[model samples]
Target: MSSDFEPILMRNVGVAKAADLQVYEARGGYQGIRKALQMSPEELIDEVKKANLRGRGGAGFPAGMKWSFLPKERKVTYLCVNADESEPPTFNNRVLMESDPHQLLEGIMIAGYATRATVAYIYMRGEFTEPFHILQRALNQAYAAGYFGKKILGSDFSMECYIHRGAGAYVCGEETGLIESLEGKRGWPRIKPPFPAVAGLFAKPTVVNNVETLCCLPHIVLRGAAWFTAIGPQGSFGPKLFCVSGPVNRPGCFEESMNITVKDLIYGSKFAQGMIGNKAVKGVFPGGLSMGVLTGDELEMRMDFDSPRKFGLLGLGTAALVVFNEDTDIRDVLLNVTRFYAMESCGQCTQCREGTGWMYKIAQRISLGAGRREDLDILVETTRNMGMMPGLSICGLPDGAAFPIRTLVEKFRAEFEQHIVRQEPGKVERVLRVLN
Candidate 1:
């Protein structure tokens, strides 16, 4: 893949004082908000609709369509900026907020204006200590610069922005759960019919958008919808920020078009620059740790919203890839993945709580050299029936939990069976070898 494409979201990233308001303004920040302030809310919404800017927060829902869901007669509209980037191996949001705070604020302002939202709350994870301070300072600067106040930039539109730090709950990354936490309640997902666009945040109409999704609005407004749509393939439009981790030569975040393949990301000179030690890839958790894994042979899959489905994945997820070398143990991977979901379940839905626990225990036993062939069947059965896909949970948490475990077991059954088969005399040594 060519590295000639200019990065829109991260254009100012490595520059000196990129997070400073003055530096951001010098680099053409706030141009989008200025342009947006002139347009009618309907017009802005229409522009985004034409641009096809989907939510970057795993759901891939159309941002304009979601904003359009707000009732025309509502008294107040709330905008919730979901800054809780809790998905494992996903830190693109943090990079954006920390590197160019004004850009994110600009995007939030544009989104707030488009949705007719009078107030915006950035629901950030509590653990984001550094980014939080940087964003807070940026918010202060934005307010001081007359970008947020009674009348922004001498325009009739007015909006307020605030940051509400969440106590690092993975479930809160879900919109409704984020809304609940913003209300100072336990972070549990709300049953729908009254989606957030209808009643959210103090029971008022709200729009919850991810950090990266909002960050695209500024570019769309400045360049025009057609320009935005032309970047990537249809249905997966615009530039995407990808995080590649593990034993890659250069494991970090990179902004690229969705047309890039998993293979390209791992081996492209401008991306991960091939796996470390020139080892063959064993498998890849192509979209964070939850979306499911891609076998070494499946590296050619396109890194896009729709392409992952063809290979039995849960969509592009956070577009974060965690690569494992051929020397890695599949059993250890399964156990670690299952354990994360087990520890993170909010204990709300019986299926998710108990089912994740069951999966984790089974994975642990198998990893500890006490595996049986029947355990695999039990794991598969539990995952198949536990998530919203099967009508068993209230939110998509179980679905996220189930996909990786099910896919890992099904795709790497041979590796799992090996663990079970070798659980004899040298089982202790085998387990120790994996642990070390």
Candidate 2:
């Protein structure tokens, strides 16, 4: 929570007429692209590498390293900016695009230039009606200002950018699924080995980056990489925006050093400002539902990508924290997340297609006070059989579907058992040790 403030991304968020083109130029908005165009594409790549900026979408992969994966030959390169923002409790992208549309345009220009992508698209979610319109208006302004289209800024580095709206499907949040949807196909994820960097979007070399990931390029290009790296701890460079929502006193999006602990995020005055109504904090999904829950002693863990593993958890996924109060039912929580994944599964992989439905049925029954004696076994066994582990599915959706159910039943086993005990009386005690 402690650091020097620059507010590069949110600089124009609250100002009147902030989305106007002249206002953006007045606030030094597109200067990063101008500076980026002055440097060679290789230099742009190297400068970002030195900055150590990671993807903000979820994976946290090195941005420069991802760009380096593209082949050197200029054979119809493309860049796709992921503005889908489909995950629950993830509204950071929506805020950025709606408030400072030009900042994103500038970032797209720099990222497209660095990757040598002659054509780029912002794959925005269909639900983002306002953000999409704001972006389109900004794009028109940029084109009219000679910042986009044929000969951008009168330089040889030319690229055209467009916005592709997606029907509201969670699978499209995945990169390959987004590409497939962009091609006017169903939103099913494609297999890898030929990643987007080598062959993506019409079988040409491409790069897919998130809205926040592209927004950082301007700062990295304008300021030095050393300045960006100095903002956070080792392996956790740059300022990160944490979307802290749920049962908290002041739930909102907060930008802070990546080193901020989960405890601070929920309790810090500058962040969530402690739990609402002095209610006791029961559990928290530290990084959206995709990452596992933290409870009891695990609340003290730091919010960095690596620190969550100290408790046998996946790394920070989107850094979107959804908290729960002591009064909330654990069974209902399990069923809520289970149903979400089930409905959004894309139903391509056998594991996720079947596993999510099984877990949802069990959780739904348990939440409604009809839990069976052997339901615990069915839940855990179903998750394991679904191969919910990473790299098992076409995309990471199954893993997201698996983590909460696995972690909740593991960490909060007693609570889950209590549901069955209330429904089946002594039957739950019979298989309790096997579950433990």
Q: Which structure among the candidates has the greatest lDDT?
A: 1
Off by over 4 Å in 1: 425-436
TM-score of 2: 0.95
lDDT (C-alpha, whole model) for all candidates: 0.93, 0.85
Q: Give the TM-scores of the predictions, in the order they appear.
A: 0.97, 0.95
Tens digits of per-residue lDDT, candidate 2, 1-436, equal 5645666667777899999999989988788998988999999999999998999998889999999999887679899999999888788898889998998899999998898889999999999889988999999999999899877887888889999999889989899999999999999999987998888999988899999989888888888899899887899888788888888999988787788888888998878999989888889998888778888567888888789778767678889999999999998888898899889999889889988987787777677667775777788777666543545678888877777788888888898777666775554344443333
Could you tell me the TM-score of candidate 1? 0.97
Q: Candidate 2: lDDT of 320?
A: 91
Which sections of candidate 2 miss by over 4 Å? Answer: 1-6, 387-391, 424-436
